[model samples]
Target: MSPDLYTVIKQICEEKQIPEESVVSTVELALAAAYRKDFADKLQNIHVTLDAQTGNFRVFDMKLVLENVSARIKEEALKLARQKKKAALYMPEFHDHDDEKFNADGVDLNDDDKLIEEGKVLLKFNPRTQITISDAKKIYPDIKVGDEYKEELEVPGDFGRMAAQTAKQVIIQRIREAERSIVFNTYKNREGEMVSGVVQRVEGSVVIIDIGRVNAILPYREQMAGDEYRIGGRLKLVIARVEMTPKGPEVIVSRTHRDLVSKLFELEVPELESGTVEIKAVAREAGSRSKIAVVANEENIDPIGSCVGQRGARVNAVIDELHGEKIDIIEWSANDEKFIASALSPAKVDSVEILDRDERRAKVTVKAEQQSLAIGKGGQNVRLAAKLTLWKIDIVQSETNAVIEISDDEPGDDTENVSQ
Candidate 1:
């Protein structure tokens, strides 16, 4: 209970990593609270000061020196006069000595001689507080009265015991708020980037991830399909967005964002990172299929092969990161016909003729045997091709002999003359 307040404050500040000034303020407030417990609420108006050097604190009831004392002893009249006087004098610029012994002409002498007598006559009193000088010097031998000091008040042994339980609750609440802010800020600007995190827990389909210092919300909607999350698992994810709230920040994280695919490629493909190979566009069904169109800015580098790596090792690593999501890397072409042809890969085509490039529609004639492969199971292949090439493609069997008609407004134009 008689611990050195200065050392106690310093130790607390160091332990909590809080500034010394903040610890001083917290101690001052705690003493104010103890004073309120010991005295009436009116004493709440009393100011408590802390000895910064000695860490001793005390309370003082300050009053203004005024003339014309009333003897009525009617507390009601005294209260009214105090209220009116407080209003005029205690504006924004009110100071401690404003109410100290001043004459009717507003002159004051800095002498404590009128202390007891003046205490009765003053209609307006401004209470000020500070740690007692005796207590301050006990904590720090170098401290003295009239010298400003910050004092740490001891929370009573009983209160300390109770606070052990209460502090846990209070700290837990405060920490959650602080952590939310940390998480929010960390992920808010990482919308299109990948972040590594530790899995803290799982709630149903959602995973609560510790993305460094804060818990990022990994919703089921953003998780890769069929990926199971176990507690304490490490994850690499894309930050979806950060949301603000009254308490703190909320971060939404995703494994399924299209950027996740691109980011993985960036991590895996050295050529892409060096800017020799550029990922022109990416379309993903997420956890099912994804297609990326890449171009070689440097002519010597084969963009598709570079992304694929030797024997499909690089792209396979990306697929494993995505929990076995299928990836197709296609060469990007400036020619719409060539690009569309590549977009629908692994299927041989007879020929492709542009029905309307501006309208983003094209007709392709594939061998009857390649029709099923071009269309794919459940039309996934062509759908991905549309998204990848940014064009609408209609695959027709060459055996059907069906001609893809252009608008009648067009004059004689031979479709075969179109370049591949």
Candidate 2:
């Protein structure tokens, strides 16, 4: 390779963070495609190798030996392929790498179950890269089925301008595709994990963030209420999902997902990270308040204390990240009644009765003075408690004994037994 070309490739590998081997292989494939487009026939199995150490080229016409297919079958397939109208049954011109067609079971091959049951090795032969056993025996007597037969071809001295242009296009396109794959995989594995990013720009309600590898988007639905995403401001976020668009991979980051709190706690508390303490459940109303339940695996460790930190340092950090949103950490209990009571924190439950075990319905009674505290502003407390426990909770004031339920679907509907 030329020193200039080597330097450029090295720079590209460093900047793109792509493997050198992948780039080199891509270059070789692009060169092969260009050579085929300019100098080879259609369906010709063309192979080209380029030496990195000392810029040298090798060209080959590669073919695979067909074990059971005969020349007569090849003739029939070619004939059918030429007849355009009758080609669907033979799946003519439907070529993968070898430009060959396979018809298994001849049933509606679309049905996966039937195809797997009755399917067998069936080939509509292509004469280009596949050679019959008899023809291969004549060329090389000891050649075996499924073995590659390579014929050395003379290398051309120079490629035309059009072919060179095609190679450049292929190299650009392939490198872009590789980069997209890398981004998709990197963010896909990070779903439900915390990531920090700088606000790049805002497109209406959607805020775009620059997160090192890719530009992740925080859509309107995932944004916390009253949260400002000012340009160049840094924010902690969790990746909700990664999807591939026609343009590229779209990394959907969220600040409102319940997992965001779990991840934040994990970062703040070493006990949570080390498995001494775990977050049992979390229910969040973004930018307002959240309730989380914690459990301890070790007897000596206090899960609540670990999450709360010394004088509220750990949870304060999470609250700061959430833009002053309130968080209530409660001890998780195994007893259903106790857990339901604890789910409604700060209310001082008088009693908890499982009204319907099958439907996960519970009745929580509190003193008349504590009724508003249990319901919270616009019934947010009871709403989050019901969500956190995955139970339909009915709040009853002991003095009046009137049951009231918070409807999470229709916000502000604190109707009696409306049920979320």
lDDT of each: 0.64, 0.76
lDDT of 1 by residue, 33-145 (tens): 44544442331233456786775556544323222222332233344335432211111234432344345354232322342234432323322322344544665667654
Per-candidate TM-scores read 0.58, 0.85
Query: Model 1 Cα RMSD, Å?
Result: 12.8
Who wins the lDDT comparison?
A: 2
lDDT of 1: 0.64
Ten-residue region with minimum lDDT total, candidate 1: 411-420
For each of the candidates, the C-alpha root-mean-square deviation to the true structure, in angstroms, is 12.8, 6.5
Candidate with best TM-score: 2
